[model samples]
Target: MSNASFWKGVLPAITTPFHADGSVDHAFLAKHAVQLVDAGSTAIVPLGSLGEAATLSFDEKVAIVATLVKAVGDRVPVVPGIAALSTEEAVKLAQAVKAAGAGGLMVLPVYVYTSDWHEAAAHARAVLGATDLPCILYNNPVAYRTDILPAQIAQLAGEFANLQAVKESSGEIRRFAAIKELLGDRLVLLVGMDDAIVEGLAMGAEGWIAGLVNAYPVESVQLFELARDGGYAASAELYNWFLPLLRLDTVPKFVQLIKLVQAKVGLGSETVRAPRLVVEGAERADALAIIDHAIATKKA
Candidate 1:
């Protein structure tokens, strides 16, 4: 399928669900993908930052994509994030997931190493050219120290036909307008940060690579539709109540926080992989306050 307009709605940057044994939970994984799509998510983005991509092994990541593909049934795109410490590994996974039935790919900066545009370009170029699958460039300067500026995004967009979108997660609303000013719809611009969704949309972002969506897919989509159709003022009340919980997606411990919310709503468990533990102590208490409050007073 073509990548045009692929970034049109809330594409969940889903959290990885782990079993009590710490194995990937394929059963819940499949069920969750279909549920999100049915709730109005435009696509399924697995093995992303929100999915705890760093902790996953290569084979585990591929299997997750395969499970999501089988679950979604080609109804919506399954765009797995292609990220590895090495360009070769990233390219290898990109091809594997493409064969596994991924509709598209989201290219991320190489793990753990920050680099200049020259280095970043080479890595992105390798992955973008790896497969002809439509690609979305994942730009989160905060998480991955490498920042692909708007002009650099234009550079890649100009060179790669498959690189059709940019997930702008710089946490600055101006980046959205900047990308639009330079690319002018050449690349579908999407907000990668949850707290900035409204501002990003106000600045011409067509979609959101949403984190909070995994817990509240219905509300996330409803909010997106409301804001998209009726503007910010119309969506303020709901967005206001949702804001406290949405901020959880911006923190470093976001994966655990989002998973906790998912667990609270009975959508999934709060388990996470090693190198990262589930939120505990005071963090869990504070997070639950927000999660429970939102659930208590939620609106469509």
Candidate 2:
């Protein structure tokens, strides 16, 4: 595939399904991948933060990507996340996922390390060099506490031909304009946050690296298309209705909240790994209420 516009559009950062005992549910994972494609997802991104990549074992990550690739049958791209704390680990991850049949990777910065832009650039170089597959550099300063600045990204783009896009989740929509001004057509910009899509797209974001798409794939797909196709009025209408549920993607308990919504929609189980429990009490009630309200008031 060509580098241009191939990585553009709605790519859902899919959740990793776990069994009651917290084991990786490979069977259901394949089924879920197929379901996402059928629901109109442009591509599938497994093993992302939404998928709890930090908690998964190496073997499990490979299996998940392999299962997703087999299930999707190349109907859409399957890009898994590569989040590592060291250059060696990240390179290993990129190589392993490429071997597992992933079309590309959503590469995040070194987690928990708080590296500066130069260190981030070096990390990207090592990881991008390890695999020939296309990559989307994830820049979520809010979550990772390290900014992958526009200048650094432009430098990486100049050095690595396979660095095709950026998941711009800085929560400042104006960063889109800054990156666009600097990189121009060098990198396709994808909005990373769920709540920021409406304005982000308005600010020249080419697509969405969405989190809530796991539970509401149809709406997510439609939202991206409407916005990209110049249907801003319609997209904004849908986005406003989706705002309440989209806000759930930004919270500390987002994994639990999204899993609960997915279960409510009959997509998957609400089981999370140890140290991260399923949503309960007022949090669960609030999530349920938002979901129910959105469902009841949904419009085309």
Candidate 3:
């Protein structure tokens, strides 16, 4: 795929719906993908940090990608996140998802071990070389300990033909300008953090790999459009209204909290995979209050 054809606009990193038995809920997963696309999302991204990817097996991950590919068909791209405990496994996954009919890849730093630039770049290069699919290098140092800085991202972009975009999630506004200054539009920049959409766009971010979009895709897309198109008064009001809920994406429990929002809105359930559970007591109540407030007084 060409750079213009893929990796732009609102790409919601979707959550994996699970059955009561703790198995992958492929049915709802497929339904949710189409729903997001129908709601104005530019693409469907599966198996990211928000999707509880750490708990899924390799086969399950491939199946999730295939499910999304079949679910969305030609309407949108199914870009599965390439991640694993080992570089070899991550390479295998990149190739497998391509065979499973994924349109693109969201290349991530290897899981768990936070490596230096040498190791991180090598791992990313391995995955990038595994397939010719267009890729978006996901750089969220907050969640994924390995930080691929702007200089390193430029190096990878120069080396790989398929490295077409960078998902900037460092929460640093300066990184957007830093990457743009280095690459000069050679690579498209997408905002990976939900709360940073306006600021990222101000610094030349053309798209969004959003998290809160799992529950509020329309509002998320609206926020991006308002900010991107310079709708000052409307954008400010919407950002103020959406800020509290969008901040949920920056926290550690974002997965459970987003799923809770989906459940509250009748979109999906709160069932997550192992090593993470649904929020409860004070945490659950606090999250519910945020979601309710957004719904009750939503204008922008």
Per-residue lDDT, model 3, residue 162, is 93
Off by over 4 Å in 2: none
Model 3 off-target regions past 4 Å?
A: none
User: What lDDT score is found at residue 120 in candidate 2?
Assistant: 79
**Weakest lDDT window of 10 consecutive positions for candidate 3:** 1-10
For model 3, residues 1-300, the per-residue Cα lDDT tens digits are: 578747778999999999999999999999988889988888888989999899999999999998999989589989999989999999999999999999899999888998989899889989999999899999989887888889999999999999999998888899999998999989999999888888888889899998888888788888988998984465998999999999999898999999988888889998988789889899988999999998899864
What are the per-residue Cα lDDT tens digits for candidate 2 across 150-182? Answer: 888888898989999999988888889999999
Clash statistics: count for each candidate: 0, 0, 0
Where model 1 places Cα greater than 4 Å from the true spot, the runs are 1-3
The models' CA-based lDDT, in order, is 0.90, 0.85, 0.90
State the weakest 10-residue window (summed lDDT) of model 1. 1-10
Error of 3 at 202 (Å): 0.8
| Tens-digit per-residue lDDT, 58-128, candidate 1 | 99999999999999947988999999999999999999999999989999999998999999999999998
